[model samples]
Target: MNRQHWLTAAVLGIALPAACLSACGQDRGGFKQIDQSFSPDASVDAPDCRHQCSLDGRSIVEACTGTVVETCPDHLACGGAKCIEPCAAAAEDRSSNGCDFYFQSPQLMKRLPPSCYAAFVVNTSNQPVELSLELAGEPVDVSKTMFLTKPGSATLLQHTGPIPVGESVIVFLSDASPEMPRNIEWELSYKACPAGVTPATFAQTLTGGTGVGSSFRLQTNAPVSLAAMYPFGGATSYVPTAGLILPVASWAKEHILVNGWEASESGSPGIQIVASEDETEVTILPKRDIQDGEGVKGGRAGRPAKYMLGKGQYLRIVQDEELTGSIITSTKPTTSFGGHSCGDVPATAATCDILAQQIPAFEHWGSEYVGVAYRPRLGNEHEAVPYRIVAARDGTMLEYDPEIPPGAPTMMNAGETVTFRQGTGDAFVVRTQDTEHPIYVAAYMTGSSGDGKTAKSYGGRGDPEFVNIVPAGQYLNAYSFYADPTFGETSLVVVRAKLRGEFRDVWLECAGNLTGWKPVGTRGEYEYLRVDLARNGRAGESFGESICQNGLQRMKSEGPFTATLWGWDYAASYAYPGGMAQRKLVEAPLGSVH
Candidate 1:
């Protein structure tokens, strides 16, 4: 007996099949088992080990003897050949690396790590299927394999791992071809498994209609996985709704109202509105029990509300239902008077000497004074008394200060009497008519000599003697001169003047010039004036027979030379003995030439 006898005994005890015993022990079968007991000289052929068997109507031969055995049909093993039952199909495998996958109705879709390898069994009649993965919006290719015709089938596919960090992916499945069954039922498996990757878990599902202005809040008890999304500064899409209105002091973002609706992260804290090129965000007003207008108003009255005016500054008003008015005040800088110099006067001593004559004519004289009284004119008097004295020839103007030297008093008063020494060039004396009342006096010198015209005279003056006697609030005339040749053949040199008075504490002085005067007819009666010019004939002319005397007489009662006296009642009365005083008046020196 050879090793085949032992194999046959072992097979009988194990309830072995007939084919296994015949193939293992006999040579009649196509398989031949080598003899293991032969000495070194033993022949290679085995004679008693031949066997045959039939599988699915096909014959097979086997020979058994030693460690090496032979059998017919190279693909079949006698003892190992047995009918294998189909196993349950494996699950389909999928891989995604920061990518995504979507499945059609019949095909199963899944998201898997790059290392995950899966197997899928194809037991149904459905044809092969195509799988696709996408990232952002682009596609990626995976391994390809064919399905077998066997009823129970399986497929092994390699899986690509997680997409590189900071990236995303997607995967999808579909029929390999349109002709194939739409329902692709298959099982898949892979060796690799999903690693550290986890599925995305959000506290709340994203609602379909949610958008930019919508409000939302994170669900309580949900583990915060900030790592889930990129650009973690904060998500603009989701906004907190309730407690978000008043966040903790440490919360960096601010809340606001936009277009009458609540908005978030609007402007810097403490500010009500935030504006950008694309949108405008405004702070939400605190809900209060008070009515709408109860709170302070915002932009109005040409200013911003407690804030600097910026590029887009505009008025935003808050009003009650009644539309009541609101007042606003702000601060700015100040403006006051700066001094100016009065122009020059005429050159002639006579013309310039009478320059003091124009002082009181200023409309502001009386009221500007302190502790002084100004009686514009004699009791109920209508006629104007000459307060200003001027040169008959060239219009040289002058002012007189009887009580004080020129420029002595910064201020002058009505009823002030100013006297001038007969031949004192341009010098004159001024006296404040009232004890303490004062007014302003200014003088101007104009015109050029040998210009075939006289030196133009312009100034302001009033009589201290008369102004002091007239009652307060009385009227007196003010005078002015204008150089007009059109009204008369010779430049008429019309001294147009007016008078205005006020009982107020401050008085205003009227303006004047020789070229043109303020017309008395245009002003109150108190602005009227009486003018007179005494003249002494030049040598070779008869005494008291010159044009100056005639002009004086003509001006004595009426015309531009006439003016009312404010205090004529207080005029000094001095009656000198003999004709000495008379001669002084008659022989008064004439105005000197330049």
Candidate 2:
């Protein structure tokens, strides 16, 4: 960079320290030129005004005497001062009447890398001005002139070559002297060159389809764009530019952060980008069957079962069996059978019996004669049939009869009552006595009977055979029942409790406290019992009495025992009895109860 200054003067004069006066030719006598190279001796006579006086190539003319001599052309102004063009003789000295000319040029413009181009400025004045270039706030190598020519002047300069990227260079111009105007303009241009270009690379790539396994790949020095689509609509696209790519390990973290799909690499070689259905969330597993609600085990020959989608939304990759196209959603709840038969047969004769052969002490109990039964009714007609009553309650197995009794209730009315009972001596005696008991009942009507006897038949009723019974201090367990033919429909088992001498309290506990127990059918039997803490009266009230049994037995020697109750009524093809029993209670340490 270069810095320069210029100077200008208006008045012309030549004064000697101590000298006498002399005169030259008098024509055009008011003006005189002076030579600045020479100085007058003290004994020499200096030129007065006009004539032949020279100092620094300027002269003091006699145009104005005693007041101050004026300098004209062809003279070196003493003390390096020069005259303005078209100068005219003046009568008196004017303090502000000095040099009136100004110097100026176009504003300077610059770019980096000196070799690329050059810049310059023009000075219209009679004086010359110096120029310099500064780069990045520092001066660079450039030419320096002792003096610049006056007026109608121009200077061309080049910036230092090999300028690094991102550096700015500025061109500065100034007059060599302070007396001159610094009004200089600058114009800058650079050589043509192509703009720098960089190629885009792959930074991250996500691979996965909706409801399918997906993976991601991240690469250095690469740009990546990702697009995702869901079952409903297009998801989102992720594009990372240079310096904006996320860390590679972020994609492998558990529960990775993502706008929609998260990235992970914990169980896979590549980045695992996961997305889920709006209705279901999915998990990524290294091997199949490793998801929740599934059993993952080593397969034959040490290989693992291939990953597959189970009932819910999940993604797993395994090595063994193929799991493609095996995703099932909304599987039905399962029902297990334990040595039970659903066909029509006597409980004792059936190959698969629900109850173990053991007679209860209460042989006259209303549940003893009950058996599982099926009655098909279409329109106003009744087509009673026998079904092997699987014991829902645990107890002794009873017999079942396919033939309906001669005087059994008919289905002439829509809501007519049908009564069925069993027992060697009297069935009604036991039913009419015990009015307080919980019973399980279920009813279902089918469109057709497979027996071929009826085109459209509806039958089958029974409460859920499985019940959860909790002892005061013991955890709840399955309390099942055995079915006998004495009970009607098997589905109509009603639980009723007898109170006082007249069987005044016949009720069922559905909700809330025991005060809200509703009356039940006294004639029917209940097969299952789900017992929770019975609410006594007010909130948190305790119901006293510890001996509780609803067809389940707690033995001191044996852990827990189960019984099944099954039966059918005479009105149906067979009697279907449904009820449960509770064994004798045993005392245990209060602290040991659970």
Candidate 3:
């Protein structure tokens, strides 16, 4: 096997064993427990009105003919109490109600590495959606926004031009009221452009979009998948970072944060929160003292600090402190995102770039995860990258493939964190044995400077960036995603699951079949592939071939799979999952919402 192609499944406590195919055996799927059978047994009628409220009992509605639960999660219509998607062709997939989405580009930097931001919204709905862009504190032409009428079609949210990097500016988007029943997916991006390029010269996707903005909130009447890019570096260079934006429906009151690479001088890695409802009260128990930033007050470590934000308003904090394991609980659903302002990977690498990921609420944290290493700069043999692990509960224990530094390390308490690097050049996997004690992991790309001499430079190989590792249990069968045109290279990393010990085929709309998927670890059911997109600079390099369209593309497979987008420019880069089902895999112990 090609050395760079080998991957591992990293379990919690950050354990990622080398070649688990034999050891993983048939028990790989049991890493976590997921109750997908949301419906009651068919042919068994409801006992009576008295038993209707039992988790698996008939609904309280008069009919009592369908599933016991009021609604089937993952959008399924129950048949004889079995949860299934509606086969009857209709205007839209009736399983999702994720219409309202809110987005805010994080404060990616505090200094030089200048760049711009952009947003993409893909129409996954069956009917045309009259879409519009909304924002305040800045003004430009908003009339260029168009109506999306076809499925799989995408459009750029129109904007005037690149806004300077500072506090995030708010952008709002939504579908026409009449088009309430719909589904859409959106992605936000940033491209490395010349410092003084005219407004007309900025890079754009195939579908010319509304330019870049700081933050955006969308209130449509359909379900939508969203993601964003966090790129900040000198003009012509960057370190791209991305996040799989979850639907607002899954946004919750409680969250535990895991931020990326940190260096004191670059600026602090921090949190950005946006209010979804009026007069929302949010309290933060910072793991480190938060240095106050725009609209946010600094909070003492381990001390509770409160802030109030109105609907659509947001708070951004970037400083020198590390915010990992910080606890944030809000009174209403509020969108939250976090990442490092700008820092070098391995600290000594040449220049610095940004890192950011939209934080999934504690309820959405999954137990089973595969830690696939980002592609190393081919020919450089620059194989090793950094990994950070954060524990969500007390007494969380973890083990890894090959132990290093604090051998057999474990989190001594809830909200504890452990940071480590992979055995230089080796790709590892980390899995959690218990679902009740789920954890969060962030994968990081090292700096471009091989020896730590360069600084404030552009296009120095790859700089720094990070994305949260989405768990295997949250993989989806199909995805509508886009790659930012701003980067010189774009690729998708896929983790495929097995069915009865056989690997299934994955299809990328333009690339036909995704070939060269290697088995992951020791499990017969998992495989991993890192395919460069159609326009990647290294398109024809063996396993590095472009698998599909450069941007605004679609992919599907016979079984569940996870796709993460990665892109890079001079010294710039960004990465984020295509999308993931926001499952409530782990929940707060009863009555303890925070």
Query: Best by lDDT, which number?
Result: 3
lDDT of 1 at 219: 15
Q: Model 3, residue 391: displacement in angstroms? A: 0.6
TM-score, cand. 3 vs. native: 0.70
Give the per-residue lDDT digits (tens) of candidate 1, residues 41-72.
11223434444221110122232322233332
- What overall lDDT, based on C-alpha atoms, would model 2 receive against the true structure? 0.19
List where candidate 3 sits over 4 angstroms from the true fold.
1-97, 108-115, 136-141, 145-215, 230-240, 292-295, 380-382, 399-412, 423-427, 452-459, 499-502, 534-547, 590-594
- Residue-level lDDT of model 3, residues 1-594, one tens digit each, is 000111121100012212221233234344443332211211112233321211211122223322234554533333333443322211122111245566755544432212344444454433333333444423333333321112212223333333221111112222213222222111112233223222211222221111122445554332344455443222243445566666566687888766665654434465677776778998878777877554456777878878887666666665555676778888897767776655656554545566678877776676556667655565332356567777787666454333332322344346766666653235345655566777787777766654425322223555677877776556656677656554556657888775324566887766677877776455345678776662345332233344343556577765567788767656667787876656556645412333
Better of 1 and 3 by lDDT: 3
* Model 1 misplacement above 4 A: 1-365, 368-438, 447-523, 526-594
**Model 2 lDDT tens row, 1-594:** 000110111100000011112222213232221111111111112334433222112344232132235555431122212353311211011100112111111101111111111111211112322333332224433442111111111122233332222111212222112232222211111111111211011112122211232222211111111111000000000000000111121111112100100111100111112222123322222212322311433333212233232221223222212121111121221111011111111111111101101111111112212222222223232433221111112221222122223323211111111223221111111111011111111111221222235322223222111111111111111111212111222222222222111222222222221233222223322222222211111121124533221211111101111122222211122111121222111111111100
What's model 3's overall lDDT?
Answer: 0.51
C-alpha RMSD by candidate, in order: 61.1, 55.0, 11.7
2 or 3, which is superior by TM-score? 3
Error of 3 at 154 (Å): 15
Ranking by TM-score: 3, 2, 1
